[model samples]
Target: MPSNDNTPRADRQELAYLPVPFPKAPPKEPRFAALRTWWQEAWEEDGVLRAMWEDVLSAPEDGFRYMAPWLRAVLMVAGVSFIVLMAKAAGEVVLEGLHQLLTAVPKVQVGGDTSSGVFAVVDQPVRTYIAQHSAGLPVAASTVYTLWLLTGITGLVLGYLSRNNGVRAMWAGWGAASVFMVWTATPATSRPIAVGLAVLAWTVLSAFAMRGLTLRRRVGRPARPARVSVKPEIHVHVPAPAPAPVVEQHPHSGCPFRD
Candidate 1:
């Protein structure tokens, strides 16, 4: 073997040209510039990015300015109308049936002779119907009817006042009455109808109360006054047109020739 001093220097020759086993030129900096260009091109092709940007820029700062008041007004009107409709339906459908039942009582006579007095000639069938059905009611049917009447009157007053507290109280009373009817009364033909009216009344009252709260929240605080700048008017004075351009000596020569 040659002397140690005669050994070839590893650092002297070009490492790139040599058959080295390591990676070539420490991986070139990724072409981020080209990547950015491709990304921009893709965005343009879809148009999605452009539309999103435009929508964001065009959206109002105060989105609820117009929407809030409009919504509140609509809800208030609707609530009032719904309450009225429920009241009418209850009176027409449920109350009317109660009226018919009450009317049957007076028609019942105790005996055939008018002088025998009304109680003596009472209609047997009507009295029997009342005996069988009224017993099932927690309270007398007359008492229940009175409770129902009170509920309607209270509900009307509360709704007119737009007082949620009053409305809720009325609903509580009405709900109790409805439960009483369910528990004590035999399943009369009118049971389902009465239950339906009770449900409608409860729902309308609850919904109207909630809508009132929503309206209060949406009204929010008063808006600040806007500053306005008024600009002064500018007036311009235009000079009169110059007398028809004078021909000077040419004009004088033409006048002399005419003379």
Candidate 2:
């Protein structure tokens, strides 16, 4: 029999001579060439497209979070203004219709057999005057409506222009004017309702205007320094020196020696 060491060495040589299987290179990563092509086509050379792309790429991590409050305020104002203006216009139409109805009623003779007593004498002329002058009702209403519409349009433009200061002032003025017009036109019976609406609208408009002014003032003011966080210092404890080793002395000899 061959020697064991020689047999093992021969086996090792045979193993080394056998061909080794190398791993195949991983299949090239699934290409996204199609997606890249699509993106290229979608993002052409248009300025608007380029701007949109840049905005998307450069947007802050929070994605316009800072503008959320201002955006909400703007929407709120717009909604309220739309509702109020619609209501005012509707009221004007209703009043105009009532005036027309009153004008159509036949005139009653006074201090005569056909007269309906004192009411005919007292109320007839008042009703007649109101009917005739009722034509002027639309005129006043139109004046106020036009002025408010213009004021609103101006305010909207100013806001878009970032002239919040001017917008605020305009809101204040328009609000006051609306209140005055409501007071001047509405009858005693309807005065309370009209006044209440006017006051409410003015209050809201003034409040928002003041808030805007405050915001502007704060913007003009310098920003305060950010506060830094301070960490508590850690103290490491060191063991006190081990008490001096106790000394032992022979009873007779007083010489001290460490045990």
Candidate 3:
């Protein structure tokens, strides 16, 4: 459409010089609705979460009573291992990874075209989502969350291991979280006793956890029909006692013992 009044169409046509205003997006409604709907919806469909929370809350008996002596040793070793892995992941993901990411991102040119593309963003940062939550979550929150998660996982597994009361699995997952925290907070080089105390927490919770994953190898377990052996009913027929012969009471001979 031709301008009704314009000093020059060419001047108006020049987008750079034109008075057409860049669209001002309305201020975003930065409102968190979690409080409003969270409480209401919390009860809707949270079976999995409920179970997890219950397991966490229902952490089992602590110390030697929790398991046999043999299991305790196994659990301690496993705890050490879990702690090592946890520390390794935390360092790599939270500390080193964050530094590299922050360093690279700022160095990157603000362009996303064939002319400028992301390459060597960070040398082999992470191929998987492993520990990637660090980027989004605050460092402290992430750490606490990690702790709580480990603890919950431990409690849940221990509650089940003792059957499924041999679903007998524990010593590892139960104390693994505590030992992990101890190992993380106080390095073995500094405080070794922290590691030991983490090994046990009173007269209960001795077992941590383990892998019964070997059981998962078989999927199709056809249930066998219960064979109830019913022996033939033995009926011993005992004849009813014959009625005592009643002596006919003679109307004339009225002896009382005659009947």
Candidate 4:
């Protein structure tokens, strides 16, 4: 109506005023806090400390429970450190020792022909037969003996501590120890075949160790009875008041008796 108000409309006037949303930035974590969180996750998620702590608690009847709380705390930290260092050193030593042993031990050759290694086969049944038979026993008797001892001893001890766990836990312990032995033994290429046989020997030894005769005797003991308090007998006695003193009155004649 006002001459149509425009020869042409301005770009600014045509645009509508509308709010636009923006994303909020995440809160910053302090360096120390972030570091502590990382360490906590490492300890828990890796399960090293947790497993050790659980093992310690598993045998409350042992030295771990009677140990001074502070000393126990110190021992836990030091034990883990020692275990880590020992594992590293032991691995290096085993590898070097195995290399030396292999060098010293000569390979047999007949008629200009070389045969496959005595312990190179990977089939479990063949390994088992070799390990059990008198001939194969000569291949790695020491390694097999060591594995058997470790599995049996560890299974027995852990089984004793956790008697409630039954044979299953002891068997599991044996299995774990055997696997660890296989993993750690140097000259791994040759040992792979023997690992199964070693584990079988360990299983037999562990079964013998965890028969639980002593455990049964210990569990059969009667529990002590709880103490109870008894109240002392109470007696109360009240003597009757002496009979009221006797009152005697003599009657007097008339008003004169008042004198």
Q: What is the TM-score (0 to 1) of candidate 3?
A: 0.22
Alpha-carbon lDDT, every model: 0.55, 0.57, 0.49, 0.56
Q: Residue-wise lDDT of candidate 3 within 1-259, one digit each (tens)?
A: 8757856755466457658778988986557666556655654566544554454444455454555455567768999999999999888888886566555543332212213122212111111111333456554333433344445565556554642533333434434544555455554475465455445441143333333334456778899999999999989999899888667666777864445
Instruction: Write the residue-wise lDDT of candidate 4 on 1-259 in tens digits.
Output: 3464555556525435677678999998776998787667756945656656665675565687675565588889999999999999999999998777655433422112122453222223232432444244544533544345455566667665565555546566656655554444425575665666656655665565555544544456687887878889888898889876554454663433221
Best by lDDT: 2
The 10-residue segment with the lowest total lDDT in model 3: 120-129
Compute the lDDT of residue 173 as modeled in candidate 4. 66
Candidate number that wins on lDDT, 1 or 3: 1
RMSD of each: 19.6, 23.3, 30.5, 19.7
Residue range with the least summed lDDT across 10 consecutive positions in model 1? 118-127
The order by descending TM-score is 2, 1, 4, 3
Query: lDDT of candidate 4 vs native?
Result: 0.56
Candidate 4 displacement at residue 100 in angstroms: 14
2 or 4, which is superior by lDDT? 2
lDDT of 1 by residue, 1-259 (tens): 6565745687556447666587668757666988787668656846656655554554454353433454447657999999999999988988888676666544433222333333212222222334456667665644544445466566655755675765756656655655454434424665565455545655665565434443434566788888888899898999999866544445545553311
TM-score of 4: 0.23
TM-scores, each model vs. reference? 0.25, 0.27, 0.22, 0.23
Given candidate 1, what's the lDDT at residue 82?
100
Return the TM-score for candidate 2, rounded to 2 decimals.
0.27
